[model samples]
Target: MTQLIFINLPVADLNRSIAFYEAVGATKNPMFSDDTAACMVLSDVIHVMLLTHDKWRTFTDRAIPDAHASAQMLLCLSRDSRDAVDAVVAQAGAAGGTADPNKPQDYGFMYGRSYADPDGHIWETMWMDPAAVAAGPEAFAAHELTPV
Candidate 1:
């Protein structure tokens, strides 16, 4: 069987988080959703479990970090093209989320932008030419990594 990835996030408001993810194109999977948690289907292999802070505590003893103050991780999603990346960021902004909290990134063969959900979880939308990626490190030799 193929391995699937499930990203569990602690959300302060379950419904709001569901709406935010739906706005960004994820559909709620009712079979795995309930009052305290939601299964947001990002793709066939990628699912996001948005759990209420209370529900999240049941699984871990560690305190939940203030996402607004510190970033635990940066989640990135790839798009088919640069326009698709920009479209999702725009959708995030329209959904009461913060768009491009960091500077946008643009290389000749790649591009990316970021957004912060209402709870301040950061997500990056990116697009890269498959040919460029297949070319490997040489393709990025001239690209400088700047803070973004």
Candidate 2:
């Protein structure tokens, strides 16, 4: 099979996490979900496995980090436009998320803003133009995210 992505993450409360993901526009997959975990379908090939803290720990011997104190992952979603980014962040806020205390990053062709989910998972909503990517990451240094 071709390589696909399945991001596994721990959630303190499965039902609560499910609600948050739904608010962020993700659909639920019954095939891989039950009382212990919920599979959030981002795309046909991309799945986010939201597991209970206990179930998640079974996958590894390592202790689960305190997500609120330290970011365990930075989940990013690309949008079609700047407005789309704003809409998604607004939706997240309405769903009990908080905007990251940082200025927006504008690299001429790409722009991004960050937010934290209720469980403190970091998420960056971004809009990147192909033309800008071709210009290279260096192109953004001049238009770096300056604080307001």
Best by TM-score: 1
Question: Could you give me the TM-score of model 1 versus the true structure?
Answer: 0.95
Q: What is the TM-score of each candidate against the true structure?
A: 0.95, 0.85
**Superposition error at 40 for model 1 (Å):** 0.2
Per residue, candidate 2 scores C-alpha lDDT tens digits across 13-82 of 8898898888988899999999999999977777888999889888999988887888656878789898
Colliding residue pairs in candidate 2? none
| Candidate 1 off by > 4 Å | none
In Å, residue 124's CA in model 2 sits off its true spot by 1.0
Compose the digit string of candidate 1's lDDT tens values, residues 1-148.
8899999999999999999999999999999999999999999999999999999999999999998899989999999999999999999999989999878998768889999998899999999999989999998886886643
